[model samples]
Each structure stands twice: as C-alpha cells, then as structure tokens.
Target: MGRVTGKRVVITGGASGMGRATAELFAREGARVAVLDAQAEPGEAVAAAIRDAGGDARFFRADVSVERSVGDAVDGAAEAFGGLDVLVNCAGIIGVDKPTHEVSEAEWDAVFAVDVKGVFFATKASVPHFLTAGGGAIVNFSSIYGLIGNDEFTPYHVAKGAVNMQTKQDAASYGRHGIRVNAVNPSTVLTPLVEGIARDFPGGLPAYEEQMTGHQSLRRLGRPLDVAYAVLFLASDEADWITGVVLPVDGGYTAR
Candidate 1:
C-alpha cells in the first residue's frame, strides 16, 4: 500500500486532473505531498483533502511559467518536507488548435511558456535539492501527441515533443547521480478540461469520446487515475532501474 512510503514529492498543477490524482495517490501511499498550482483555492482544497485522509500534504502557489516563482515554490516545498525525493511535472496546457502556419507567434510562445518552459524551470529548480538528497525521481507528463503527430493543437504537440527530448536529456545527464528522469505519454484522459472540450465539440461529448477511442486499441477514454498510476510507478522505488524511458501510458493509442 505504501508504494512511495516517506518520499517527499512536489507536483506541479496538483490542483486538478491527473496532477490531483497523482497527489492524492502519492499521499495515500505514504508520501508528503506539496500541491503546487496557480489556483490557490483548489490547490488548498487538494492538500486539505489529503490531510483529512490522514496524509501529509500542503499547498504551494506558483506560476510554473515564471522561473522565480517555480524556484521559490520548489524550494519552499523542499523546506516544508525537510527534503525532496520526487518532482512531477504535470502542469501543462492544450494550446490553440490552429495549424502550425496559422498560429501566431504569441500563441505559440504562450503554449511553450507553460508546457515546455515550465518543465524546464521546475526541473532546474529541483535538481540541486535532489543532488543534496543524493538522488531522486522526476515524472514528466508528455502526451501521445508528443510521440506521434496529429492534426490538432500544433503548439501543444510541439511543446510536448520538446518535453520528451528534455526527459531523455536530463535522464542521461543525471543517471550517474542517481536521479532518474522519465516521461509518461498518455492518450485522451477524461479530465474536467477534456470533458469541457468534449462538450464543446462539433458533435458533442459522445461523438468526441467515440472519435478519441477510435484511435486507441482499448475502446475507451483514459481516466486521471490511469495516468496517475504510471506516475506512481515512475516515482516509486520499484522503478529504481528505470531511467531515460519515454513510457507510453496510452491505451495502445501509440501501438496503432
């Protein structure tokens, strides 16, 4: 039950979706969780919920796109927890759905600012703490779109691709120090954000679900827990020998 027993974890975007699920699960498994998100109310709620459930947790507000904010929050979490053992880069956005040529520079930059630069900033801030601890783990949330191209969210796809490369680069650079970096590339998960997107789809939610599942070998949308479990495994000691891996959590979406 205690897969990550006593580990100190900092999860970006822990207020919602897969990030929240990962936070809750980590706490249940005996980790001291720091929920970092720009949304203070929800972030606090997530941490409070964990504490209510007899887990150690706290909320830290931070804008991941800003280097200073990320640094402060990461440091704060480490201080609060006495040290850091894991960092989960789950803060991201599904940016504008325009084609690459049609996307404005601002739009592209905005997406990269959150999806790509956020990961870079958070990882940069956590590495020293990890080194101080003698080693740690990092689980980055990439997407199937990062591994394979499609016809939507060009900027998001590109940003995640960069995340995949960064995961490999950091994994290679840090393995000698006992730090392991890996990415989880999930298919369409039915988070509140995705549910909203589905509701606004041309043919509505049912059609959106049908269309998404059509690409997956498993004929269903993913759940937050689906991706959270992958994060847990990567963060846990069971995966001590694993690093530099871009693991696909997709329900065979990439298998096709």
Candidate 2:
C-alpha cells in the first residue's frame, strides 16, 4: 500500500478499463489523480468515486489526438495536483483489423493519430513539467501485437512499434535529466471493447477465450488489475532505476 504516496498522476483514458483501474489503484496508494478522457460522465464519475473514497481526484475532459487538448489537460493536472509526478499514456484505439493491403490510408492515419500521436502529445506536454521538477516517470500502453506480427491489425501494430521505439529513444534522451520512460505491452485483455470484438469472432467469446488462454503460459485472460499493477510498479519510485525497457504484462504470452 501507499507505493505512490503523495505523487500527482495524470492518466489519459482514465474513464474506463485499464485506465480506470490504474486511477483507482493510484488513488488508493495515496496519489492525487487527474483522469483525462473524452467521455465526460464516466470520467467525472471516476473522480467523484475517488473523492468519496477519501482520495484526491479530479476529471478533465480532453481528447488525446489533439495537441492543444493534451497540453491543456496536462497543465490542468499539474495545476490541480500542485505538480505532475507521473504521466500514463493509456489512451489508444485498435481501429479496423485488416491486412496492410486492405487497410485504407485514412484508416492508418486515424489509428496513428490516437495510438502513436496521442502518446507523443501527452509526453511532449509533460516533459517540461518533469524537467522543472527534476524528474518524473512515463508509462505508455503498448500492446503485445506491437512486439509481434499478425496478418491483421497493421496500423495498430505499426503504431505500437513506433511507440516502443519512442519509449526507448525518450529514455535515452532524458535519463540524464532524471526522466524515465517505459512502455507496457499487454496481450488482449478482457475489457469491454475487447470482449465485444471477441463476440464477433468465428466461435464467439468461448473460443476466443480458449485460444487466448492457450497463448499465455498462465492459461488465463488478463484482467484490468493485472495490467494496472504493472503500470503502478513502473510509475512508482521502486522502478527508479528501470527505464528504456519495454515490459510485457502478457501473462507469459510472449514466452510461447
């Protein structure tokens, strides 16, 4: 408990799924949280819940794809929480799953806008504050699909690959400045969006789960908290020396 005590955290996509779980966990550990998302109701609800639970939390509506929106939200978080200690880039999209030849240019661009560009926008906005404070942690949500190849999901994989490389580059560039950057690559987690996707699969949710379970040595799908715990570790002081690495929270899926 209290691993991130007194830290001020800004999490994009904090309204739901892994982002929400992380926000709740960070708040529980004594961090002041700012949840940024396009979804107003759920975002505000998350903040209210945190406050009701005796944690300092607030919600700010922002679109990750827009630089100005990202900048404003980061600045707002810094202002509200006194200063930003951690920035978690959890805002992302899967886009339409299609082969490279079949995917449209617009499709590719759209995914890049949110998946890859959003990370850049958020990190870019936070870097100055981190430098001012002498240090900070950045945890980006990449995907197992980014590390490996698949016939479908070209844009998503490429964007995540870009994110992974960016994480390494940023880590190298800012390590001397006390800024640490890392990314978490998770396999398909059982979020609502993923679950809905699974329902459309050939054999539906059961078959999808079975296949996913088999892909991981742990033989189970990942929960939001599973990934959230890893994000917490990377964002916390315990990982002060850990930077420039891509950590896989894949339930051992990468081992296979």
Candidate 3:
C-alpha cells in the first residue's frame, strides 16, 4: 500500500480522468501529491480530498503551453512538498477529428502546443529539481495513436509520436543523472475527453463503445484507473531500471 511512501509527486491535468485517478492512487500509496490543472475548483477539490483522507496534497493551476506558468507551478510544487521526486506529464488535448489535408493549421498548432510543448515545458522545469534530488522519475502520457496510425487523428498522432521520441531522448540524456524517463501509451480510455469525442461519432456513445470494444481483446473500453495503474508503476521505484520504453496499456489491441 505504501509503494511510494514519502515520495513527492506532481501530476499535471490532475483534476479529472486519468490524472485524477493517478493523484488519488498516489496519495493512497503514501505519496505527497501536487495536483496541477487549469480548472481551479476541481483541482482544489482533488487536493482537498486527498488531505481529507489523511494524505498530503495541494493544487496548482497553470497552462502547460506557457513556459512561465509551468515553471512557476512546478517551482511552487517543489517548495510545497519540500522536494520533487516524480512527474506525471498527463496534461494533453485531443486534436480535431479531421484528416491531415483538411485540418486547419490552428488546430494542428493547438494540439502540438498542449500535447507536445506542454510535456517539454514541464520536463524542462523538473530537470533541475530532479538533479538536485540526485534522482527522479518522469512518466509521460502518450497514446496508441502515437505508436500507430488511425483515421482522422493526424495532429494528435504527430504530437504523440513526438512525445514518444522526446521521452526516449530525455531518458538517454538524463540516465546518467539518475532521472528515468518513460511513456505510457493507452488505447481508448473512456475519459471525459474521449467521451466527448464519442458523442461526436455517428451513433454517439454506444456506437463508439462498440467500435472501441471490437478492437480490444478484452471486449470493453478502458477506464481511467487502468491507465493510472500503469502510470503509478512507472513512477514508482519498482520501475527503477526501466527507461526510454513505451508501455502500452491497451487490452491486447496492439498485439494484433
């Protein structure tokens, strides 16, 4: 239960979905959590819930695409926790469901800003803190689209691909300093973001669920906690020897 005992962890986008689940799980496992999100009320609620349960936590608001905001939030988290040991880069945005040829440049840029640049900014701000601590872990949230191709997901796929490579590059660059970098690529998790996308599909949630289920050997869509467990594993000391690897939390979808 205390796998991450006394560790100080920061989870971006931690107010909802997979990030929220990770925050709760980390707190339960004895980690002091820093919940950073753009949503104020919900973020504060998440932190408060952790504290209510006798866990240490706090909330920080920041737009990850902005360097200054990310720097300030990360710095504040470190100060609040007295030090930082783990970073879960879960802050991301889905792109317009359009083909590359049809998608607007603005759409592409926006996706990259949050999904790619956010990861970069957060990692940049965390490195020095990690160095000061002598070691740390970084678990980035990639996607199945990042590793494979699908229709109407060009921008998101591109950003996720960049994330995969960036994760590897960071791992290679910082391994000597005891900083472990890795990414978790999940498939069709039924988060609120994905739920919204499902509604946009032809037959709404049911049709989307059927399609997603058919692709999975488990015959069901993934839950946020599914991905959260994987993130927790990578962020914990159990994965101390793992780095630069992209772990897929898909239900055997990628096995085919």
lDDT of each: 0.96, 0.93, 0.94
Q: Candidate 1: TM-score?
A: 0.99
In terms of TM-score, how similar is model 3 to the real structure? 0.98
Residue pairs with colliding backbones in model 1 are none
**Which candidate number maximizes lDDT?**
1
Write down the TM-score for model 2: 0.98
C-alpha RMSD (angstroms) for model 1: 0.7
Rank the models by lDDT, top first. 1, 3, 2
Q: Itemize residue pairs with steric clashes in candidate 2.
A: none
| CA error at residue 219 for candidate 3, angstroms | 1.3
Model 2 misplaced regions, further than 4 Å: none
CA-RMSD of model 2? 1.0
Which is the better candidate, 1 or 3, if ranked by TM-score?
Answer: 1
For candidate 2, write residues 107-208 as lDDT tens digits: 999999999999999999999999888899999999998899977788999999999999999999999999999999999799876988898989998899
